[model samples]
Target: MSRQAIGKANCFHDKGHHADCTLSSYPYMAAFGIIQIILSQIPNFHKLSFLSIMAAVMSFTYATIGIGLAMATVAGGKVGKTNISGTVVEVDVTATQKIWRSFQAVGDIAFAYAYATVLIEIQDTLKSSPAENKSMKRASLLGVSTTTFFYILCGCFGYAAFGNKAPGDFLTDFGFYEPFWLIDFANACIAFHLIGAYQVFAQPIFQFVEKRCNRNWPDNKFITSEYSVNVPFLGKFNISIFRLVWRTAYVVITTVVAMIFPFFNAILGLIGAASFWPLTVYFPVEMNIAQTKVKKYSPRWIGLKVLCWVCLIVSLLAAAGSIAGLISSVKTYKPFRTIHE
Candidate 1:
């Protein structure tokens, strides 16, 4: 989704006018998705170590550039004057509207923090150790702390710089000035970062399906072994026909959905509203409460339980808002409209 968004932004940046890039993205998405599907065939998670590191470096690079740009604006007196910041907390709005907007923002934040859903799969890639959980805890604490600091800085500074004029993607909103090359480089980093990130997340789905297929099929015997094909140059590089078909289908489906619905923020809102409370908030709290087995009437238990319910209720309401937002977006939606459109 972001790749397509960036592609569209590049259209504006290069041509100084909006051009629908969705049709062009058809081939690009197909090619990239296929690359990801093929890369998923590598069973050893360690093989992705370098790519993951590169992705992290690129992510940090772009984030630092973003922060520096915002800071530059502040220092140069280019910061806009806008009263929109923190309006969600203003008393001028109706209570219901305030709650709805607040929850909507919560949904976005939850979506951004949605890595918890896949953190266990990532942890499984670690070597087995009695202290594995402790290691993961320390790693999570450090990672979260660092990322939170950057997120806060970027958000506060970007809002201060652009205020109501801020684009959904700050990098794409920059003018072609002295830092034009830097802006382009930052965008390139995002694209390359996503290429690796996609596989890391998509591999879990591939593994799940492949495992189930292996369990049910019980061998390459589901089809005649004759169904396989070998590439001549890559000696013994045999590809199972069934495996090829199944994984390719998964890639095609995902790519199609991404192309058809390129609303990145709306999709994130939906994902967060749908899964964040259950996976991130409710389950962990319940697990802690169950493990501790505090008295049901005690303050700790009661407080935790209440928090769980609040998270659940808030998630549901946020989901409703997300659905509403999606429907409204569709009313103005074009299949591949540029930002100017």
Candidate 2:
């Protein structure tokens, strides 16, 4: 029953349906599923052939790509729109409204590492700085650099461990055999992560709905009633109509894709990585260029431009490589087709 519910949730959340909401939650869920699959096959550890490991590695690479693309997209958007407001309130509200979109953009860069490196570090550093904090720039540079290193490290580890035989998705690879305690812990982590992702995407939508409701309702009852109606299955589950509806949609979409896609992990990873380049590498440089344009050009400025160009080239190459892999994977899709005749 729980599994079925999860499947339903994922179906409604996948791309082409509620893409914005899915963008935030899908990566984490996909990762969780992959891990589950790996652990399941632990008893068959000796039977874990080289081919399986290689497939797993490929999938992981794709996942990293997905994250990278997301990060790049977010950073790029921020750079492009830096001039919108000068006041703190305006900035806060604007940033909040677009937080999911930004995160989605950030996901394009390097998923876990990019978020940790660029978004988390840069945001924290900037927020901590005084108006005259000259060190903020240096700090951000160091932070992003560190992030890149970690991403490379993880990718290398995954490749070395699995090579070309890695599983297409983590869960299917492992057979979902982790101990109950560990499984419980993992499930908890997945649930919270999903919630966080949902909040990131749904906050803006919720706010918009709230405002519209307020105008139309003039009283709280109408808003409450409408909110109930908006959430479909969740409303039936006796959960908080808002949260239930939001999360249910996410879970359903992910589940559906997990079941349908032959190499779900690789596909998700590819999407993520492609998104990251623009968000992390390309956007930040562009933003720096825009921010520094008013000041006199210096060696640092020239260096930044050169760096931007390099990042752009690298990002393009990475994206191209990912697409090529996807195409190759598609060409060899004999394993996943059903034999109905």
Candidate 3:
């Protein structure tokens, strides 16, 4: 939600008015948050298949558009041996900075492809079948492969076109003198896709919180009929009042945080650093090692555990660097300092 809000805010950046500028993200965040909450309140998770399709379509459309734009730039004779000046590009790099950036790149990769975070839930959405494992394996393989290809393709083309002039966000790297309709379309697609993605991720968190709240304040089956709705076309549906309240509150809290700290890269880096190792690397390896009963200190066990240890150390360093970077950003931060800024 925070990242989405920040992205939306970038759409209308005004540099002169620095203070209270990022307040623009608040309305956008609230609007999308409402959409997410409503969609998440759907009776069953499986019913979100339509949303998933929309997410996929929107994502693919924007990705294709972005790639097309990059290729067009390259074909238009924009890229050259001479680097473009006055662009937000990273041309020079020292060894120390490169090392820090490698750690930063880990976080960016984690953010881009953090499938492990919701793999279990996504698998659960699949229909029960004898070949469920096979089906899921094939799906995962194809999805990851396709996404990876696109990622690499886009990166290669984008770098080729912009060279050292690429900004942090490739979309915004399209110079601003001309308000490209394609850029607007791309941002809209991104925002629309995020509406679905937010619900997919937030639904699980909502369910977890609802469960905890239920344990604390058990729902009374005998509650007033107002909580139960009998729509003419939609049949009777029971709405958990407490569930609605808490989820709505959660959306508000996240929105406020997004507005207060509109640093998208920093927050993403932080989340990636925090979740990359535990959710993606350590848990899976440890689970496999335990299931296989790998002998303690054996080469196999050591090798398996070595990845986890390496991930832990690297992720910690990344997280520390991310935090330091975020602090520095905060210290020098100005609100709505133009899109390129």
Candidate closest to the true structure, highest lDDT: 1
lDDT of 1: 0.70
Runs in model 3 lying further than 4 Å from the true structure? 1-23, 80-101, 173-179, 215-226, 231-235, 334-341
lDDT of 3 at 205: 78
lDDT of 3 by residue, 55-119 (tens): 88988987887788778878888873333332232446555555565566667767666667667
User: If both were scored by TM-score, which would come out higher, candidate 2 or candidate 3?
Assistant: 3
TM-score versus the correct structure, for each prediction: 0.81, 0.41, 0.81
lDDT by residue (tens digit), candidate 1, 123-146 = 887777857778789988998898
Could you tell me which residue pairs clash in candidate 3? Answer: none
Report per-prediction Cα RMSD to one decimal. Answer: 4.2, 18.8, 5.1
| lDDT on C-alpha atoms for all candidate structures | 0.70, 0.42, 0.68
lDDT of 2 by residue, 40-62 (tens): 22222232334344433443443
Worst ten-residue run, lDDT, model 2? 169-178
Model 3 superposed RMSD (Cα): 5.1
Candidate with the larger TM-score of 1 and 2: 1
